[model samples]
Target: MTRPQPRPGIDEIKPYVPGSAVTGFDGPVYKLASNESALGPSPKAMEAYEAAAGKLHIYPDGSARVLREALAARYGLAPELIVCGAGSDEILQLLCKAYLGPGDNIVMSRHGFSVYHILAQGCGASTKFAEEKNLTADVDALLAQVDENTRILFIANPNNPTGTAISGEELARLREGLREDVLLVVDAAYAEYMDWVDYDEGTSLVRAAIGTGAENTVMTRTFSKIYGLGGLRLGWAYCPPSIAEVLNKVRGPFNVSLSAIEAGVAAVSDDEFVDDNRDHNRRERARVTQRLRGLGFEVGDSHGNFVLAKGRGDAPVEDVTALIEFLKTRGVTVRQMGGYFLPDYVRISIGSTEANDVCLNAISEFASQ
Candidate 1:
């Protein structure tokens, strides 16, 4: 008897490995693995989430209307140009589904988010990785890799794992160089955490795509970061009318949950909460980076809520496993970077003051030993 088979590229796709949440030590664990907000969700959002429990029996608004309008008002974008999804990850998946095929390919930075690779492969498409300079996306190198077959170009500003970012000028240059037909998707998942002068969230680029005949750019964002709604899985994209229509057509009828919608509406409306969260992250992130540098680790100037740090001295790669184990013994969970091909580095999320102190003390102890 013959067995059924999945799609061609499905088997070949490497499954994504999330940061480890487990530890051997029977003590308090500080989960600084994933880049979750240390401040937690807005109290108003929590109230909305609880209130939405009564509406679980009813189907969510397929359009996610109120949430879209809230995002629009907050960001100063047209509501019709927005497309909400379960998370920004789903928005990427929808884009891949609509645009990618066996012969097509997507281009992205070598050290960028790994989910882009998985999504492209799921659509039976290949991914081209451009080399980065100083752990940041190089506009010239990325453009060089985009050939005739490239359908999409993905950029995660203040990129994950590495936590480096390119300037707004570089982003615009990349867009100008791309073919009019190739879709440019800027994944600004960590945008809210970036308080840098040169940082651009790619919203202007998305708006620029409107009047231009070639409406080929998109900017995707998340509620998981500054909004602290990672558990609810709400995200959205700023798109041109054409792309928004395409996504709306292909997406699940009620992709976002009722709870997610209500919480998102409340979260976005609470500007004071977001401001406080950003301020806390800015302070903590700077402290963490400075302390890690003082510990002799090679740390980039990260704009995101996490820092990517490599071990001390000449043979850093050899120190990775031992250091991670040492931190585990101290009940701190930092992500290993073997999956991102940076075996020497570890990514640690910025946590509360107490949590940060615990993690730092663990590393300091490891260094002494």
Candidate 2:
């Protein structure tokens, strides 16, 4: 029999694991695994989706023009600068494919979003894991790792698993120090949850680069988080017009679905819904983080919809495992951070007040035990 052949990198790649979606467990399970909005989709977006369902037979606009226009208008950017994708994940992959190849390298934080490493490896590109300080991207450390061969740098604002953010000044410094040829891809997937005065989604950075005729910065955004459109799988990237053109060439023409396009357009226009969700997440994230820290866990300062708490520092791993199990029995599903290389930490998403109460109670009980 003939053996199936594959690329060496493909063989080494591990598939991403989504949060469990099992229903009808012994107790009611409040899933906080995936960093999704608990508020659900906006009424406007749902209406648009329902209206578009009848037109499923027709192919989606290849350029996603409607959604692009909506996003551009909202962001004060040119429509030509945007490239929509299935999700920000796809946009990240596109950047990797367009810019990275064998012999090229990308710089990323040690515990940044997994997609950066996955996409880099998928393209047969090497990665330099910049040492993070306090679970946040250390811009200076990342700058030190850059070389001529480093084609891309990915920074996840409000980084996953740890939910820590780098300040705007630090980001600007990193950009100033970066090699002219290196492209910075800022992933602002959780930008809406931030209430910091100096926090930026990297839009200004991208705009500054464009003004300077520098084509080395791109920023990605998603409809999945604050918009509650994870199921729609809609995301976009803002880049130099030249880079956007290259990505468009490599991207599948019909990468986005009809329903997704309609939902994305409506979602972007629903400012009230987005604002309300952001406000709720900001308030609850503080509440959750404070409560977790009060329980003697070292919780990081989070600017995202999730808060990460490090269990007892000197405690055994089994002790943490036991706490997780106890919480699972209480129907609160938080993300275990072993995969993200933080074994003593668990990430809990900011949910509705009631859901958060249940999770806090579970944690309290586990601590008492």
Candidate 3:
């Protein structure tokens, strides 16, 4: 039986492999694979989510105006420029669908978020990767890769897997030199975890563009990280008015759910909760990196809520694989970075103090062996 053909690049997409969730031997599995919050959502957000249960029969506000307004209050972004989506992932997909096509290409850092590469391929567009210097996005290298075919360029500040970031000045330099025709997307999924004086998550650029009536750049954010709403699939993008209009037309009418909207609105209002999560992540991230280094591992300095643990020993790849197996046996789940081309590294999220201790102790045991 012959079937209708799919798109040219559809088959080439290796679907995203998420971080591991459980350990087979789990009595109490310490999940440090996904970069989720150590402390969960605010009590206010949880109450809002539960309150939404009564309205399940009715449809959500198609525009998500209330949530947009709340986000505007929190971030000082113009409500008209914000477009809510199921997740930043959905917004990214919308960007690809709106701009990508055969012969078009997207450029991103070599170790940037994996979803960018997958999304570009799914849209029948090719992806170009610029080499990273010291596990950080090299602005010049990224710009050098751009040509006539490049339609979009993505930079994940506090990038996934490696958890490294470039200074805002560096980012601005890239934007200043970039072709005005290319859409530059700054994915700030882990922005909430960063407090480095030099980091701005491209907001300054977006604000500057908005002031100049420019529309070639956008910044995307997620509720999944700091808000602990990963399960609810909520995120939004702050775009120039023109880009927002394009996204609104192509996006689902109710891309964000009632519960997600309510929770998100309440979550942003809980400034204390966000601050506490930031504090916990900051403290634990440093401790984890310190402990991993104490174990003789080459741990990278990370701004996000995770650290990349690389084996410093000879045969780093084999050592990392052995470390993974050893940790799994002890009921610890951590992310392997092979998919991101860092086969010798493991990305461990900063979990609760107990969870962090468990993971650190497990690695310590493995190193001792």
Candidate 4:
């Protein structure tokens, strides 16, 4: 008997492993592993979500018009150029499926989001990883890896695992260096947490792409980070009209649920809540970074709501594992960076003051030992 075989690249695609949430400890767990919001979702969004319960029998608008319009009004973007998705993950996959083929490839920073490789490979395309500089995406390195068959370039602003970001000038240089035919996907999932003077969340680049008629750049944003809507799985992309059309064609007609649409509309409109969340993340991230450095760990300046840290001396991997084990015993959990090729480091999401203290205290005790 003959069995149906998967496509060539499908076999090569390593499944995407998400941040771990499980902890052997049964007590109150501080789950900083997933980088979720510390303060949780907005009250208005929650109210809207609760109200949406009545409409569970109804299907969401195929176009998600209200949510798109709300997003446009909030960001000063064109409604027609916005495409909503289950999450930025779906948007990324859609782009890969649309542009990549058997011989095509995508270029990304070596430590960029791991999902990009899986998505490209799922489309029968290969992935090229360019070397990074100081845990940040390097424009020259990424462009150097691009070949004639490279159809896409993915950059996660304020990249995960490392939590380092490139400046706006650097982003512009990268875009200018890329071929016009190549698509530049800027994943701005953690954009709300970035308050650096030179950093950009990618809206300006998307707008510039529209103004210059380049139409090659796309910026994807998520409610999962700042809005605390990860469970709802809501995200949208600010695309050029042409790319928006393609995504709309490829995405499910009702890709976004009624509850997500309602909650998203309320969440985006809650400017006060977003500002508060940003401020909280900024303060806590800085404090955590300073504390980690004080504890003799090498911590970098992070623009996102997380920090990447490692031991100062030779055996960083062992040090990280020991710290993680200790934190777990204290009911606090963080992430290891092995999947990002940074096994020596650990990625800790900035949480509430109590949670941060728990993690820090655990590390301090471990250090004392």
Candidate 5:
């Protein structure tokens, strides 16, 4: 008898390559590969997680109502417009499932998150990548790529790996230029940490779309970054009421875990912890960018909690491949950006002072070689 075969596009999909978490020489390893909070979760969130341990047998609330209300209150959004998922990643996958299919396509920047491609194609859809300029998402270029088959356009605000972002005006222009039917999915996973004046996480656009009855835009955010809830895997999307209703229909009855809902509610309420983490990331990002540039490396203009550093000097240091091998030997693990199509750059997450210093010291030594 013949076995069941997988779908057509599934075979073409390349699995996402996550950042390195360990080095072979593991003496006091400093893991800075994934862009996560070094400051850790808030005390209140920790307490909430612990509180959830006693209720392990009870099923989680299928609607995730409490967490939805908390996110609405924190962001000044309507609870009815929010949808919670395992992570912003799940939210993206849900969108692909809802909107895309065979012969359909999603357009995005060439350097946008790899998961977008994975999510779209896994659902039997294709991806269209527009070019970028000056390491930033070019709005006109993206708009130019949108044709009749384009069902969704995904963009990572303060895009990962490169950590560069486009402004609100450019985003608005792109939205207005698109046909009313296409969905605009903005992945603002790094929104909380950005102190930029013009970045609004696409909330305003989503609201405006609702007001005009277009309801063509939405923004996805995560608890993994500033909230330090990576392990819990909680995230939400602020969408028009219609979109939220559609997502609720297809998602699992208890899509989010009890612990995640409890921890997320506590995490959003702790404004102080969030502020402190943002401040630390802001300061360290500046310091690290400056230090990397001073050491003769080309660092991207990053607005997220990490920076993209490329070797630009002579000899082995100029080759990022060698630089990564060198850092690995020193018990340091930073992400190689080749998967994101950035072969010459290494993306380093901003860590606590000691972690950052150790990572920098290792790089400094490599620069001297």
Candidate 6:
């Protein structure tokens, strides 16, 4: 039997692996992987989902009008400038498909989101990796890698795993320095968790760029993190009207589900829930970071929902591995950062007071061993 040949680039691509939900143990396990909200979806979002359940047989709104209008009002952007997708990940893929090609290249940092590289490869595009300074996107380093062939620059603000963020000034410098033709794709998936003094989350930056007759900047955001709508796979991108039109052409009609649209609409209007979660994350993130530091681990300055803790340089890999296993036994699950190219580090998402206590106790027990 003869099999059809696939693109050479496709053969070499490795798929993105999300955090696992199932552990071998039968008892309850607290998941700290995937950086999801520990408190779960907003009460209003759940209610919206329940209400939409009865209409499952009917097709969802192909344009996701309700969610788009809600998002526009919340962000102070026009609905025409926004395009909703099944998830922010899907929107990323759509961007690649719409902008990249065989000879084009995408610029990203060394430890940037793995999806950027994967999607670029799938589009048969070359990827140039710049060195990240202190687990943050080095704008200077990234600029050095940009050339005539570079068409897209992907930066995850308040980036995942490391949870580091870039300032608005620094991001502006990078944008101003880039060539006129290059598109700056800012992935603000973890933006909601950030409350830094002067960070912009690239929203105003993108808006400013477009206002100044530069339509090359685009920003993508997700309801998954702050709104607790990860399971619904709802996200949206803010771009120039022309870019949004192009992306909408390639994106699947009805890409977002009916329930997801309802949930997203409700979540955006639930400002109280957003504020409470942000407040909880701010307090708990500090608590978790301090505890980890006390355990002889070096943790990065994190602004997102999670913190990254590193074992001593000389510590055995087995010791770190053992710590993860021990934590699992205590029904606590945090992400092992081997996939993020930081094998010595682990990422723990901030949970409720009780969950945080359980995780901290597990860390102490493992370190004491």
Sliding window of 10 residues with minimal summed lDDT for model 4:
17-26
List, residue by residue over 202-267, the lDDT tens digit for candidate 4: 878878887888889999999998899999999999999899999999999999999999999999
Model 6 Cα lDDT, one tens digit per residue, 1-369:
999987769998888887656467777678887788868899899999999889999998898988889998988888988999988999999999999999999999887888999999999998999999899999999999999999999999988888998998999889998987899999999888877777877777678778878788999999999889898898899998778989999998879998899888989989889888989998999999998898888998898899988865587456667778888888888777786688888888898888899889888988887
Clashing pairs in 6: 86-233
Model 2 lDDT, full chain set: 0.86
Q: Which stretches of candidate 1 lie above 4 Å from their native place?
A: none
RMSD per candidate (Å) reads: 1.1, 1.5, 1.1, 1.3, 1.4, 1.4
lDDT winner between candidates 3 and 5: 3
Tens digits of lDDT, candidate 5, 1-369: 899989988888889877776635848888788888979888789999999999999999999999999988888989988999999999998999999999999999998999999999998988899999977899999999999999999989989867898888888988888899999999999988777788768999999899989999999999999999998999999999889989998888999999999999999999999889999998999999999999988897898899998867564234788878888888778887877788777889999988999989988998887
Query: Which runs in model 2 stand beyond 4 Å of their true positions?
Result: 21-24
lDDT of 3 by residue, 1-369 (tens): 999988898888899998776635938888888888799777789999999999999899999999999999888878888999998999999999999999999999999999999999988999999999999999999999999999999999989978889888898888887888899999999998887898878778887766766568899999999888899999999998889999999998878999999999999898889888999998988898888888899988898889998876779999888888888888888888999999998889999999999999988888888
Q: For candidate 4, what is the TM-score?
A: 0.97
Q: Give the alpha carbon lDDT tens digit for every residue of 1-369 in model 1.
A: 889998899999889987787546798899899998888888889999999988999999999999999999988999999999999999999999999999899999999899999999999999999999988899999999999999999999989988888889899999989999999999999998877798779988887777677899999999999989998999999999999999999999999999999999999888889898888888988899998889888898888899999877788877877888888888888888877778899999998888999999999888887
**TM-score per candidate, in order?**
0.98, 0.96, 0.98, 0.97, 0.97, 0.96
Per-residue error (Å), model 6, residue 239: 0.4
Candidate 6 lowest-lDDT run of ten: 311-320
Model 3 residue runs over 4 Å out of place are none
Q: Which ten residues in a row have the lowest lDDT in candidate 3?
A: 18-27
Provide the clashing-pair count of each candidate structure. Answer: 0, 0, 0, 0, 0, 1
Clashing residue pairs found in predicted model 1:
none
Query: Which of 1 and 5 is the better model by TM-score?
Result: 1
Residues 1-369, model 2: lDDT tens digits? 889877568778777767655344586778888988979887789999999978999998999999999999998989989999999999998889889888889999999887788888888888899998878889888998998899999999878877888778888888888877899999999888877898888988888788778878999999999999998898999998778989999999999999999988898889899889988988888899899889888888888889888878577366567777777778877777776777777888888898899999989988886
Of the two candidates 2 and 3, the one with more favorable TM-score, higher being better, is: 3
Residue 140 in candidate 1 has what lDDT?
98
